[model samples]
Target: MSVIAILVLDGLPGHHLTTPGLVFGTAAREHPGVAYEVRLCAGPGPLGIGLPAPLPIAVPHGLEDLADADVVLVPGHDGPRAQPPPGVVDALRGAAARGARIGAVGTGVFTLAATGLLDGRRATTGWRHTEELARLHPRIEVDPAGSVVTDGPFLTSAGIFGGMDVCLRLLAQDHGERTAGETSRELLTPLLRHADRVQEDIDRERAGSAGIEPTLRWLKARLHLPLTPADIAAHAGISVSSLNRRFRARAGVSPPRYLLRLRLDRARELLLDTDEPVERVAALSGFTSAASLRRHFSRQTGTTPRAYRARHRPATSPAG
Candidate 1:
């Protein structure tokens, strides 16, 4: 059995403490001969002080347990900007030196960053803390796009549900894509959010803003049509320059890029949910042809449409 040590610090979020068990437990249950032992290692502090009120629980393990652990995970805490608890940094460094894979979830990246292991490595944290992480650790390359960033044995995630994504990725690495995908289905969660889902999240945040809500709705409705920046500008009753500015400000991309993301999202949905041929999927998703769809799809998702469908589509679904 692979031993996973969870280094629990003060102010640990509730979800961070449990996600590993949720994922690994399901994996072991589903796959014969696969086993994982998850241990919660308490940091230097009075335990349970940071958890939600009236739900304190005891953690029996301590930092020494990290020495033999195959994987060490540090969950996000409230005090990322502050120094880590006593001996935490040295313990983490020793674990890494001994060939243990170390990971940090959310603001926990800040804690891991304190050990200098992440220097000159690409990492990510919660989007809100990306700038702070960059400011504090100038040597660590902070990538805000990927929910989970892996450099060598050290992994960091954007936190919250991203914790699940990272854990699933670890599971995939440990076992295989089939095990990871089966575990994801059993847990009823996507292995990772597609790029379009990420863009939709940004759009949702901007949905309340009156400046771009109508245009976003209009764009989604006409995703299948051939559209240009001029068409989008006319729909929004603004000049092309104004449309570009608004899109950049609200959606964080140009109008054309935003539209492409919408089309990609639609294409993904069709590929997974329907048996539509590649040509038909392309036409319906506003790509000029199957070749065009394949090019853009590969650029964004790193796989051809047919391959993506074969990998992710349900077994019972008819092949297109």
Candidate 2:
């Protein structure tokens, strides 16, 4: 069995941080039984400091679990926020030194990057944290804007809603695509060969509500067509003011701002997928012009539209 370890710490976004194991653990239980063993290591051993909560995982292992692991996974965390537990950094470094295949979700990349393991390598984290990740590790070539990026043995994802994608990628590699596709179906989440889920969400944000979810889904389905808050409120069967409050509460963003992200998402796909001129991609994605598209894309992604396309484009093409 290939041992996999997940570090659990204080204030971690429990859901995003834990998805990989649960999802991949499901794969382990399937018919034909793959030899993947998952464990949560508790430590500051062979290193520094002590472990944090959910004490003594019943895995019949300790920090020593990593010493024998084939792969190590770090899930997204909220804290010890930006910095990793000193113990985690040391352990990760040790694991890599021993040749463990490592992966992370969301800001977990920060922890991995801190080990100096990700230097000069491509990695990712939550879309919201892309800039911060890049700033902290410029040599890393951070792709927080994308769902999943593999830099040799270091695998990472724009975590949050992205751990599943990263795990599935690993699954595809360890098992085959049919196994991965089946796992994806069992997971009932979108399949992202590289960066699908996050990118799809970006694609979706355009047709979404300037208000809240589910209701926004209806609106996102119509981005190429013109619509407004009033139209949205009417469609969702709520007064404009009520809709605004609901959106803020549920999505923590205004309806229009959310819609803007969606439009930008679509614009990015066009930039990469089509030979469309920037101006044309702009128009197609509902931006006023190429200039408008570049401004927003750069602001959101920390790289210019063309630069982003060039860097992230499939291996087929040359420089953009």
Candidate 3:
């Protein structure tokens, strides 16, 4: 189970607070193996909202929760320029030091920038505030147009819906694209957006220019066979560590995770595009047996292959 702690500052937007909860909560509810304990934490007092005549609300936890969280989310507050309270900065810096994946949504990026962890890292805030973020924190590279920018453990999203995008990407990393897609469908949302297209373009440029594009293509062509990291390294004509480094630099995910997504994608294609039975699909997609395919497929997609095919593929052909 992953522990997600949302750090709420006084005057934080209510919508921002609930968005992550909705996303991660939905993922956990729909996927069997994915679990998350989400909590809201404020420092030393009742929570305060930015709304006119907002009432004080008590949060269930405090700064201590941030220390042990697997992921800590910071949401936009009402005042973009207001310096984060001393305790907030300290807790954020401490969380970053402890290697908790930290995310700042919208103008919340300002609060994160105040902690200096985002210094020298690629980040972005809401488009409207990007200029101020750049002007205020010259050390941080702010992309005014980026809907989401991830630099290692730190993630920043430009707008409110961008928060949803961040959550889906995190879900993909945790489970897989199929799970993320199902979660998105459950929410009546589309998983891919302009930011993802932009990211794909960036990934493509990086991979192609780095000369590993052919290696990736080759791996895709051969995903139905048993392959190892060492095999991939040899195919790329590089050491394992070098291959990992290049993949990390260009793709933002490890080679194995990338390949797994590829295999699952192929399986999905086969399930939807052909009438092959589950056993054949399993064999063709590199799973050792129908049970292996069923387990992984159900885990990643929240549906059996038969069900997925029934839903996505036509039940009958046109009469000739």
Candidate 4:
């Protein structure tokens, strides 16, 4: 049984503020021996991070709480001026120095970065704030695609609910897969997301120009066809070279990759919805063959198409 401290600063999104209570409280129910001593800590002040009150509980402990914890969890907070609070930063620094694992949920990384703990560390935050985080801490590696990033004692998660994934990761590291899986069952965290799915969708949207958008709409319509980059470029009334440049500049990927991602997403949907064979699904997804589809799908999602389809297909109901 280890003590975990979850620091709640002022201005945290109400929903994000509640996630730790849900996850940790539920985890306590599922695993009796693996007790988690949870606390909501605040700095020394009556208003305490500008939280709305009638205060729920008097501040039991201040920054001193960090020193006794095995792990320190920081939830995203707003009104992070050019720097996070000095006392808050110092407590995190001291905790990390004493070998406590530090985890941040969402924009909470801002607080950790302010302490210089995240310098040169790999980290992530909400997708909307990835660039902002990178710009603020130029030395830190901000990975938009990663749900969690770990460098030494520091770990940071992407967004609000991503904290549960980080918690599961920590549990897996300390105990084992079974413990983490059981904890996940109790917490109900999303098991996994295809690594590039979100990025691919964003890439597709920003990759093309206004003229290219109409052509992309057409390409999506004909995803059943094995359309080439040259064909798409021609449809956009641009040379393949210019179209490639535009996509690279805007979305940071090539046209062909964008198209593949679109087809793959549709394939995933169809796999969930229909009982199509791998070869037929691949053809409809614009992949040249089943093996090719499996290769790319596994690369992107870490799961084979057949396995995913089998797991996701809905069980049929009998007519009443």
Cα lDDT of model 1 overall?
Answer: 0.83
Each candidate: what lDDT? 0.83, 0.68, 0.78, 0.72
The sequence of per-residue lDDT tens digits that candidate 4 reaches over residues 1-320 is 78778776766656555666666666667766666777767787542333333233354667887789998988777665357664888899889899898888788888888889888667788877888988988999786654666656777887756777777766755654567777776655343355357757766677533346677689789988878888888888889998887765654447886787788888887776666787888888888988998887765444588766544442522110
**Candidate 2 Cα errors over 4 Å, as ranges:** 16-18, 44-60, 80-83, 189-320
Q: 151-201, model 1: which lDDT tens digit per residue?
A: 678888888777787788788667756789899889864534575588688
Stretches of model 1 off by over 4 angstroms after superposition:
49-54, 189-320
Between candidates 2 and 4, the one scoring higher on lDDT is: 4
Candidate 4 weakest lDDT stretch, 10 residues: 311-320
The TM-score that candidate 2 achieves is: 0.55
Clashing residue pairs in candidate 3, if any?
none
Candidate 2 lDDT over residue span 33-130, tens digit each? 66676777755433222224433223345666678877788776555246676577778888888887788887677878888888877767776787
The candidate that achieves the highest TM-score relative to the unseen native structure: 1
Q: Model 3, 1-320: lDDT tens per residue?
A: 88889888888767777777888888888788888888898888556776545757789898887889988888887776787865899999898888888888888888889899989877888767877899999999776555567666788887657677777767765676678889888885344566588778987789776668888999889977888899989989999999988876665556886776687788888886777888888878877788888776764554677766765554633210
- Once model 1 is optimally superposed onto the true structure by TM-score, how far is the C-alpha of residue 196 displaced, in angstroms? 9.3
> Which of candidates 1 and 4 reaches a greater lDDT?
1
Clashes of each: 0, 9, 0, 0
Pairs that collide in candidate 4 are: none
